[model samples]
Target chain A: MTFTTFMQHLVNSISLGSLYALIAVGYTMVYGILRLINFAHGEVFMFGSYMAFFAMTTFGMPWYIAFIIAIILTCIFGMLIEKAAYKPLRDAPRISIMISAIAASFLISNLGIVFFGGIPVTFPRPDIFDIRIVIGGVSIISVSLFIPVITAVALVILLYIVNHTKTGTAMRAVSKDYEAARLMGIDVNRIITFTFAIGSSLAAVGGIMWALRFPALIPFMGIMPGLKCFIAAVIGGIGNIKGAVLGGLILGFGEIMIVAFLPELSGYRDAFAFIFLIVILLFKPAGLLGKNIAEKV
Target chain B: MKRNNKLNIIAILAFIATLFILNVTLDPYRLRIFNLAGIYVILGLGLNLVNGFTGLFSLGHAGFMAIGAYTGALLTMSPETKEMTFFLEPITPILANIQLPFPIALVAAGLVAGAIGFLIGAPVLRLKDDYLAIATLGFSEIIRIVLTNMQTITNGALGLKGIPGNANIWWIWGVSLAVVVFMVLLIKSSYGKVFKAIREDEIAAEAMGVNIFKHKMMSFVIGCALAGVGGALLGSLIGAINPLLFRFLFTFNVLLIVVLGGMGSITGTVLSAVVVTVMIEYLRVLDIEMNLGFIRIPGVPGLRMVVFSLILLIVILFYQRGIMGSNEITWEKLFDFKNRIAKKITRRKSS
Candidate 1:
C-alpha cells in the first residue's frame, strides 16, 4: 500500500480506538463503583446518538451546538437512570442489582425503539467533516481528526477530575470500600451517580462520533460496541481509567488489522473481542492492569 | 434429613399428580408449549444448580446446546444424504455411511455437548463470578462464530437444515418431565444439598469440608448437558437451525426467565418459562387492528416486544420475586389449611 493509504488506515484505527475507549470508560467506571455491569450503559450510548440526531434535525440547531446539547442531555439521563432504576437496589445483593441493571437496560432499549423507532437513521454529517484533507498524498475524512482530539480532551479532563478533585478522592474511597467510605462521610451514593454521569456522557460522545463515521443509527447499534467496550474495560483492568483507553485502542486496531491482514476471516471479526475476553479471563481474572481488589473470601 | 425426606415424597407425589392431570387434559397446542417449558425447566434447573446453587455465573449455555443440536442433526441424517454431502471430506466411509437411530442420536448429542461443556468449564470455572460471566458470554459468541464459519460440519450460517422433526408433543413433555424428576431427585440427594449449601456460603461450605471445585464443575456439566438436550429438541421443533438464532438476545431471554421465575425456585422457573413463551405468542395476537365503527385502530409491528420489555421492567420493579420466591412448593405447603378442593372432597364423602 502507498504511504498515504497507510496513514489513512492508521488515522482510522486511532479514531476507532478512541470511540471504543470512550465507551469502555463508562462501563469500567460504573463497574468500579457499583461492582455491577451496567448492561444498560450500551442503551445509554444508543440514547446519546438518537438524542444528538433529534437535537440536530428536529431542533434545527447547528452541528456543534447540537452535539454539546446531546452530551449534556445524555449525562442528565445517565444520572436519572441511577436514581430511578439503580438507586433503590443499592443495598440489594450484587446479583440482584445486576438483574436490575439488565432490566433497566431493556426498559431504556424498548422505550428508545418506541420513541425513535428501529429504522436505521442516517446521522447527518456536517459540511466541515465532509471535506477531505489530502495530507501526504492520502485523503482522510475531517471527522477522523476530531475523534482522537475529543477523546484526548475528555481523557485529560477526566484525569483532572479523578486525580485532582476532592470528589474524585471520595469516588476512589467508596469504590475501594463503600461502608468504610460512608462511615468517613464520603456521600457514596452521590459520588457513584456522578461517576455514572461522567462516564455516560463520555460514552455519548463516542456514540455520536461513531454514528458520524459509520453514518448509520439503529436502536440495537450500541449492543455490539457496548459489549466490545466491556470486553475492553475488562481486558484493560476494570477500574483503571487509562487501562480502558489502552484496551479500546488495542481492540480497535486489532480488529481492523485482523480484517485487513486476513481478508477471509472477516466473518470472525465479532469473535475477535470475545476471544480476547476469554483469554484475559483465563490468565488474568483481575484484568491486565487492574489492581488486586480481591476480598478475603 | 428425615423431616426433609417426608416432605420431599409428598411434594413429588403432588407434582406427579399435577403432571398426570395436565397430560390427560391439555390440548396438543398447550401440551407442546408445556413440553417446551419442560425443556426450558431442565435448562433452568441445571443452570440454577450451578448459578443459584454453586454461585458460578455461566452464560455459555447456548454454546453447549449448539454442539448437541449439530451432533444430533448430523447423526440422525440419512446415510445416503451424508454420502452425497460430505463425500469429498476426510470423513471415513464407515462414519459417513452410518445412520444412527433417533434415540442414539439424542444420547450422542447430550454426551458430545457434555464433553464440550467439560472442556469449556475446566479452565474458565476457576474464575470468580464477574470474570466467569464475561468468559462464558464470550464462549457463547465464539461458538456462534465458529459454527457460522464451519461450513463442512455445520453448513455455515445457513444452518443444518432438512433434519427430521422428531420432537413430538409427548416426547418433549416426557423428556422434560423426566429431566425435572432427575434434577429434583438429584438435588434432594445428599450431593444436591451440598450444592445448595455451597450456594448459601461457599467459604462456609468449604470450611465444612465441601469440595467446592468438584461440585461446581459437576453442576456446570449437568446444566450444559441438559441445555444440549433442550437444543436438540429445539432443533427438531424448529425443523431448521441457524447460528444467528442463538444470539445474545436468546441468552438474555433465558436469563430473564430464570430471574423472573425466582432464581432458586424450581416450580417458579418452569412456570416463568411457560408464561414467557405464552406471553410472546399472545403478544403476536395482540398486535392487530380491532375497533368499533367510530374508532379505526391500525396493526402495529414490533409493538409486542416493546410492551413485553415494559412488562418485564415493571415486573422486576414491582414483583421482583416473580411468581414465586425462593421457596419451593412443597406438598405440605400445597395441602396446608382450608381450600375449596379439600372442603368439597370432604363434604362429598360425608354426604
Candidate 2:
C-alpha cells in the first residue's frame, strides 16, 4: 500500500479504535464493579443513538442539544435497567444475573423493533461532521478526526472523576469489596448507579459517533459492535481503563489491516474478533494489562 | 418399586395413545406444531443437561444444531435435489452422489455434531460461568460464519430447499421420547448425582473424587448430540435448512424453554417445550392485522418477540425457579399431592 493509503487506513483505524475504547470502558467498568457481563449494554448503546435520532428528527432539536438529551436519557435508562432487572437479583447467583442481562438485551432490541420500527433510518449528520479534508494526497472525513478527539476528551474527564474525586474512590472501594464498602459508609447501590450512569454516557457518545461514521440506524445494529467491544475489553484486561483503550486500538488496527491486506478474507471480518477473543481467552485469560487474581476455593 | 414400574408403563401407554389420537385427528398445521414441540423437547432436554443439571452456561446449542442440520440434510437429500440446490456453486463431488436413509442420516448427524461438541467442549469447558458462555457463543457464531462462507459444502447463503421431509410426528416424538427416557436414566444414575454435586459446589465435588472435567465434557457432548438431532429433525420437518436458521436467537428460544421449564427438571422441560412452541405459533395473531368490525388494528411485526422477552424477564425476576424448580414429577410426588388435597378437603368439610 502507498504511504497516503496507509495513513488513511491508520486514521480510520484510530477512529474505530477510539470508538471501541469508548464502549469498552463501559463494559470494563461494569464488570469491574459487579463481575457481571451486563449483556444488555449493547441495547443501551442502541437506545442512545435512537434517542438522539428521534430528538433531532421528531423534536427538531439541534445536534448538540439532541446529543446531550440523548446521553442524559440513556444514563437514566441504564440506571432504571439496573434497578428493575439487576438489583432484584443482586444476591442471586452470577449466572442468573447474567441471564437477566441477556433477557434485558433481548427485550430492548425487540421493543426497539416494535417502537422504532425495524427499517433502517438514515441518521441526521450535521454539515460540520460531513466535511472531508485532504492533506498531502490523503483524504479523510472530518468525523474521523473528531471521533478520536471526542473519545480522548471523554476519557480524560472520566479519568478525572475516577481517580481524583471522592465518588471515584468509593467506586474503587465498592468494586474491591461490596460488603466492606457498605460497612465503611459507602452507599454501594448509589456508587453502582453512578458507575452505570458514567459508563452509559460514554456508550452513548460512542453510539453517536458510530452513527455519524456509519450513518444508518437499525434497532439491532449494536449487537456486533457490542460483542466486539466486550471482546476488546477482555483483550485489554477487562476491568482496567487503560487496558481497554489499548485493546481497542489493537483490535481496531488488526481488523482494518487484515481487511486491507487480505481483501479476499473480508467475509471473515467478524470472525477475526471472535478468533482474537478465543485466543486471548485460551492463552491469557486475565488479558494483557489485567492482574491475575487467584480463584477462591 | 413394582407399583412405580406399573405406573411408568401406564404413563407410557397413555402417551402413545395420545400421540396416536393426535396423529390421526389433527390437521397438518396443528400436527406441524406438535412436531415443532417435539424438536424443542429434544433441544430443551439437551440444554437442560448442560445449563440446568451441570450448571455450565453454554450458549452454543445453535451451532451444534446447525452442524447436525447440515450434516443430516446433506446425507438425506437425493442427488437430483442436491444438484438443484447447489446451482450457484457446484456441490463437492463426493457429497454430490451420496444419499442415506433418514434414520441413518439422523444418527450420523448426531454423531457428527457430538464429535464437534467434544472438540469444542474440551477447550471451552475449562472456562467458568460467563466466560464459558461467551466462548461457546463465539464458537457457535464461528460455526455459522464458516457455514455461510463455505458455499460448496453448505450452499452458502442460498440455503437448501426440498430436503426429504421424513421427520414426521412419529420420528420426532419417538426420538424425543427416547431422549427423555435417556435423560431420566442418566439423571437417576450415580453419574447424575455427581453432576448435581458439581452444580451445587464444584470444589466439594472435586474434593469428593469426582472427575469434574470428565463429567462436564460428557454432559456437554451429550447435550450437543441432542441439539444436533433436534436440528436435523427440525430441518427435515420443515424440508429446508439454512445457517441463519441456527442463530443465537434460536439458542435463546431453546434457552427460554429450558429456563421456563425449570432448568434441571425433565418433566418441566417437556411441559414448557410443548407450551412454548404452541404459544409461539399462537402469538402469530399479534403479528397480523386484526379486523374487529368496529375497529381495525394494524399488524405489528415484532410484537410477539417483545411479549416473549418480557415474559422471560418476568420469569427470571419473580419466578426464578420456573415451573418445576429443579423437581421432576414422580409418581410418589403426584400421589402425595393428591392425598394432601384430599386431606385438606376432608378437614374443610369437618370444620
Candidate 3:
C-alpha cells in the first residue's frame, strides 16, 4: 500500500478505536462494580443517537446543544433503568439479573423500532464536522480527527473523577467489596447509580460520535458495536478503564486491518471480534491486564 | 400409591384425548401453531437440562438448531427441490439427491448436533459462568458465519426454501411427550441427582466424587441433541430454513420461554411452551390496525416484540420463580387436588 493509503488506514483505525474505547469504558465500569454485563448499555447507546437525532430534528436544536442534551438524558435513562430493572434484583441470583439486563436491552431496541420506525434514518450531520483535512497528500474527514480527541478528553475527565474524587473512591471500595463498602459508611446504592451515570454518559458520547462518523441511524445499530466493545472491555481486563482503551485500540486496528489486507474475509468481520473473545476467555479469562483471583468455592 | 397410579393413567388418557380433539377441530393455521408449540416444548426442555439442571449458562441454542435444521432439510429435500433452492450455488453432489425418512433424518440431525455439541462443550465447560456463556455465544456466531459463507452446504445467505412438509401434530407432540417423559425419568434417576449437585456447586460435587466434566458434557450433549430435533421439526414445519432465521433472536425467544416456564420444571416448561406460543400469536394483533369509535389506531410493526420483552422483564423482576419454581406436577400432586375437592364438598354438607 502507498504511504498515503497506509496513513489513511491508521487514521481510520485510531478514530474507530476511540469510539470502541468510549463504549468499552461503559462496559468495563459497570462490570467492575456490579459484575453484571449491563447488556442494555448498547441500547443506551442507541437511545443516545436517537435522542440526539430527535433533539436536533424534532426540537430544532443546534447540533452541539442536542449532543449535550442527549448525554444528560442518557445518564438519567441509564440510572432509571438500573433502578427499575436492576436494583431490586441486586440481591437475587446472578442469572436472574443477567436475564433482566438482556430483557431490558431487547425491550429498548424493540421499543425503538416501534417508536422510531425500522427503516434506517439519515443522521443529521452538521457541516462543521464534514470539513476535510489533508496532511501530506492524505485526506481525512474532520470527524475522524475529532473523535480521538474527544475520546482523550472524556478519558481524562473519567480519570480525574476516578482518582481525585470521593465518589470514585467509594466506587472503588464498592467494587472491591460491596458489603465492606456498606459497612464503611459508603452509600453503596448511590455509588452504583453514579457508576451507571458516568458509564452511560460515555456511551452517549460514543453513540453520537458513531452516528456522526457513519451517519446512518438504525434502531438495532448498537447491538454489534455493543457486543464488540464488551469484547474490547473483556480483552483489556474488564474492570480496568485504561485496559478498555488499550483493548479497544487493538480490536479496532485488528478489525480494520483484517479487511484492509483480506477483503475476502469482509463478510466474516462480525465473527472476528467474537472469535477473539472466545480465545481470550479460553486462555486469559481475567483478560490481558486483569489480575487473576481464585474462585471461592 | 394405587390412587397415584390411577391418576397417572387418567392424565395420559386426558393428554391423548386433547391431542385427538386438537387434530379434529383445529384449522391449518392453528395446527401449525400447535406443532410449533410442541417443538418449543422440546427446545425448552433441552435448554432446561443445561441451563437449569446442569447450571451451564450456554447461549448457543441457535447454533445447534441451525445445525439440525440444515442437516434435516438437506436429507429430506428431493433433488429437484435442492436444485431449485441451491440455484445460487450447486449443492454438494452427495447431498443433492439424498432423501431420508423423516424420523431417520431427525435422528441423524440430532446425532450430528450432539457430536458438535460434544466438541464445543468439552473445551468450554472448563470456563466458569459468564466466561462459558460468552464463549458459547461466540461459538454460535461462528457457526452462523460459517453457515453463511459455505454456500455449497447452506446455500450461503440466500437460505434454503420449499422443503417438503414432513412434521405434523402427531410427530411433533409425540416426540415432545417422549422428551418430557425422558426428562422426568432422568431427573428421578441417580444421574439427575448428580446433575443437580453439579449445578448447585460444581466444586462440592467434584469433592463428592462426581465427575464434573463428564456430567456437564452429558447434559450439554443431550440438550443440544434435543435442540437439534426441535430444529429439524421446525424446518419441516415451516417449509423454509435460513441462517438469518437462526439468529440470536431465536435463542432469545427460547430463553424467554425457558425462563417463563421456570428454569428447571418440566411441567412448567410444557405449559409455558403452549402459553408463549399462543401469546406470540395473540400479540401479533399489535401489528394490525384497530378501529374504535371514530378513531383508528395504526398498527406498529415491532410493537409486539417490545411488549414481549416488557413481559419478560416484568416476569424476571417480579415473579422470578416463574410459573413453577422447580416444582413438578406429579401423580401425588394430582391426588392432593382431588383430596382438596372432596374435603370442600364434605365441609359444605356438614354446614
Candidate 4:
C-alpha cells in the first residue's frame, strides 16, 4: 500500500479503535465489579444515538446540546437497567444473571424495532464533522481525528476518577470482595450503580462517535459492534481498563490492515476480531494486562 | 414393576394414538406448527443436556443447526434443483448429483453436525462459564459468516429453495419421540450421573477420577447432533432457508424453550416446546391490525418478539427453576395422582 493510503488507513483504524475502546470500558467495568457481561450495553449505545437523532431532528437542538442530553439520558437508562434487570438477581447464580442480561438485550432491541421502526435512517452529521482535512497527502474526515482525541481525553478523566477519588477506592474494594467491602461500610450497590453510570456515558459517547463515522442509524446496528467490543475487552484481559484500549487498538488495526493487504478477505472482515479473541483466549486467558487469578474451589 | 411396565405401555399407546388422530385431523397450517414444535423438542432437549444437566453455558447451538440444515439440504437436493439454486456459481460436482432419501439425509445431517461439534468442543470446552459462552457464540457467528461467503456450497446469501418438504408429522414426531426416549435412558444411566456430578462440582468430579473433558465432549457432541437433526427437520419442513434463518436470535428462541421447560427436565422441554411454538404462532395476532368494535389497534410488526423477550425476563427473574424444576414426570407420579383424586372423589360422595 502507498504511504498516503497507509496513513489514511491508520487514521481510520485509530477512530474505529477508540470508539471500540470507549465501549469496551463499559463491558470491562461491569464485568470487573459485577462479573456480569452487561449484554444490554450495546442497546444503551443505540439508545444514545437515537436520543441524539431525535433531539436533532425533532427538537432542532444544537449538536453539542443534543449530545450532552443524549449522554445524560443514556446514563440514567443504564442505571435503570441495572436496577430493574440486575438488582433483583444480586444473589442469583452467575448463569441466571447472564440470561437476564441476554433477555434484557433482546427486550430493548425488539422494543427499539417496535418504537423506532426497522428502517434505517441517516444520522444527521454536523457541518463541523463533515469537514475534510489533508495531512501528508492523506485526506481524512475530521471526525477520524476528533475520535481518538476525545477517547484519550475521556480515558484520562476516567483514570483520574478511578485512581484518585474516594469512590474509586470503594470500587476497588468492592471488586476485590463484595462482602469485605460491605463490612468496611462501603455501599457496594451505590458503587455498582456509579460504575454503570460512568460506563454507560462512555458508551453513549462511543455510540454517537460511531454513528458519526458510519452515519447509519438502525435499531440492530449495535449488535455487531457490541459483540466486537466485548471481544476487544476479552482480548485486553476483560476487567482491565487500559487493556481494553490496547485490545481495541489491536483489533482495529488488525482488521483494517488485514483487509488492506488482502482485499479478497475483505468479506471476512468481521471474523478477524473473533479469530483474535480465540487466539488470545487460548494463549493468555488472563489477557495481556490482566492479573492471572486462578479459580478457587 | 409389572404394573409400571403396563402403565408405560399404556402411556406409549395413548401417545401414539393421539399422534395418529392429530396427524389425520389437523389442518396443513396447524400441522406445520405441530411439526415445528417437534423440531423444537429435539433442539431443546439437546440444549438441556449440555446447559441444564452438564452445566455448560453454550450459545453455539445455532451454528450446529446451520451445519445440519445446509448438509441436509445439499444431500437431499437433486442436481436439477441444485443447478437452479446455484445460479450465481455452479455447485461442486460431487454434491450436485447426489440425492439421498430423507432418513439418510437426516442421519447424515446429525453426523456432520456432531463431527463439527466434536471439533469445536475440543478447544472451546476448556473455558469456564461466560468465557465459554462467548467463544461458542463467536464460533456460531463465524459459521454463519463462512456460510454467507461460501457461494458455491451454500448459494451465498441467496439461500437454498425448493428443499423437499419431507418433514411430515410422523417423521418429525417419530424422531422427537426417539430423542425423548434416548434422553430418558441416558439420564438414567451412570454416565448421566457423571454428567450431573460434573455440573454440580467439576473440581470434585475430576478429583473423583472422572475425566471431565471426555464426558463434557460426549454431552456436547450428542446435544449438537440432536440440534443438527432438529435443524434439518426444520429446513425440510419450511422448504426454504437462508443464512439469516440461523442467527443468534434463532438460538435464543430454542434457549427460551429449554429455559421455560426447566433445564434438567425432558418432559418439561417437550411440554414447553409445544407451548412456546404454538404461542409464537398464536402471538401473530399482536402483529396484525385488530378491529375490536369501536377502536382499531394498528398492527405492530415487532410486538411478538418484544412480548416474548419480556416473558423470558419474567421467567428468569421470578421463576428461575421454571415449570418442572429438574423433576421428570413419571408413571408412578401419574398413578399416585390418579389414586389421590379417586380417593378425594369417594370421600366427597360419602360426605
By DockQ, the best candidate is 4
DockQ of 4: 0.83
| TM value for model 4 | 0.98
Please provide, for model 3 over B234-297, each residue's C-alpha lDDT reduced to its tens digit, 9 standing for 90 to 100.
9999999889999888888889988998988899999999999998988888988988989998
Docking class of 2: high
lDDT of 4 by residue, B103-211 (tens): 9999999999999999999989999999999999999999988999999899988999999999899899999999998999999999999999999999999999999
Instruction: Return the DockQ of model 1.
Output: 0.58
- Per-residue lDDT tens digits for candidate 1, residues B208-313, read 9999888888888888888888888888776778898887666667776777788777778888888887776667754677686898777565577667666666
DockQ of each: 0.58, 0.81, 0.78, 0.83
Q: Please give, for residues A123-229, the per-residue lDDT of candidate 3 as tens digits.
A: 98899899998999999999998999999999999999998899988898999888989998999889999999999999999999999999899999988899899
Candidate 3: regions farther than 4 A off: B1-10, B291-295
Ranking by DockQ: 4, 2, 3, 1
Give candidates' CA RMSD values in order: 3.7, 1.2, 1.5, 1.2
Candidate 1 lDDT, A76-131, residue by residue in tens: 99999888878877777666666677667777776676678778899999998778
* Candidate 2 per-residue lDDT over residues B124-217, each given as its tens digit: 8989998899999999999999999999999998889989999998899999999999999999999899989999999999999999999999
Which candidate would rank higher by lDDT, 3 or 4?
A: 4
After TM-score superposition, the amount by which residue A281's alpha carbon in candidate 4 deviates from its true location, in angstroms, is: 1.1
